[model samples]
Target: MASEPPDAAAASRRDGGRPGGLRRMLRRLTASEAEIEAEELQRDVERHGCQPARQVERGQLVSVTGRLRTVVYTPRTTVPTLEADLYDGSDVVTLVWLGRRQIAGIEPGRALTARGRVAIRDDRKVIYNPYYELEAAP
Candidate 1:
């Protein structure tokens, strides 16, 4: 890897001021040029339109705008799970907060945002179910 110049205004910088950090990482990841170009185009397009995100025929980005209708906390389990009933106004999503790092942070009725890939669990659609959690409202 080569060193990049110290000019902060030059553009995005990575590594030792080298040009290859982003490109090399992209190359190593085997990202397609068209995909990269599309991403760049998407970045430009992002400022002009609503954000694009992963959605189930059922789910959307877990944001603070959702309503909190339920919460369950277990105390006897080896690892606690914070189960939340998140409503996106139209319907509800059941999100599970697993692991001490996240499960410890959940609270009932707190406005939250959780972003993750959505999937069908127990035949119902959920986002951040096994992966999502209660994100503190900023």
Candidate 2:
């Protein structure tokens, strides 16, 4: 039998050989459903060129894309706020729109991209009055 060069062997290993298949299967078997979903969402975030919620820093202006997990309208006597939790599979960032009751299509399971400065309120990541664009339903 002929022997392959060291470089060729390395290339095959990097290009998804038997080892890669085994690793991928093991990962799928060991990872939870939520973890796998999160990974997929993270990949989508990268494809959209937006920052992941987990990596967003306080006081930094950033754009994050994710699915809305929840939408709640808090109607206070003074100020009304519409809040939605955007989950990027890595973390959640709360989006708050002030002085409003609700906006059409701002609902759970809807995907969107929001841009604003990150803030920490009650130990949770928040973006107040963010500029957001709704993603088409998938």
Candidate 3:
């Protein structure tokens, strides 16, 4: 007849009465599939002698290869930009093509390599007008 403690009830509610729910919740909160993949990609890039996005320093010239995670067109700006996020398993760098709406073969889910100088704009890593090459289709 006694009411359950709020903390115990909350924990049970969180994990469906399953054991290690807290651990699972912590892992889910701390890591995502994208993040895990990024970490793995980082290792692979390093193993192959390429700099990962996270290891790229400001003003450093970098050549990074990764899959395009997103491609967005900003038409409302004074100078339109075609922005794409490239994730190489370690981190993501935003590639901005100024005065562009789109480029052939530069779409999301495509593998490509971008080479440019690293810069931080608005606290996000970005590479403007990066020279890009599409990876060979598998």
TM-scores, one per candidate: 0.41, 0.80, 0.69
Residue 126 Cα positional deviation in candidate 1, in Å, after optimal superposition: 2.2
User: How many clashes show up in model 3?
Assistant: 1
Distance from true location, Cα of 59 in model 3, Å: 0.9
lDDT of 3 by residue, 1-138 (tens): 998799777877979989888676677679988776666667657665778787898899999888889999999658999999998986789999999998999999888888999999988899999998887775
Among residues 3 or more apart in sequence or in different chains, the pairs in candidate 3 whose N, CA or C atoms overlap within 3 Å are: 38-89
Residue 67 error, candidate 2, Å: 0.9
Candidate 1 per-residue C-alpha lDDT over 28-100 given as tens digits, one digit per residue, 9 for 90 to 100: 4697755654454345324434233223344554332243567786554576766676554334566766543
Misplaced by over 4 Å in model 3 are: 1-36
lDDT-superior candidate, 2 or 3: 2
In candidate 2, which residue pairs clash? none
Clashes per candidate (backbone, < 3 Å):
5, 0, 1
TM-score (C-alpha, index-matched) for candidate 3: 0.69
RMSD (Å) per prediction: 14.2, 5.1, 9.0
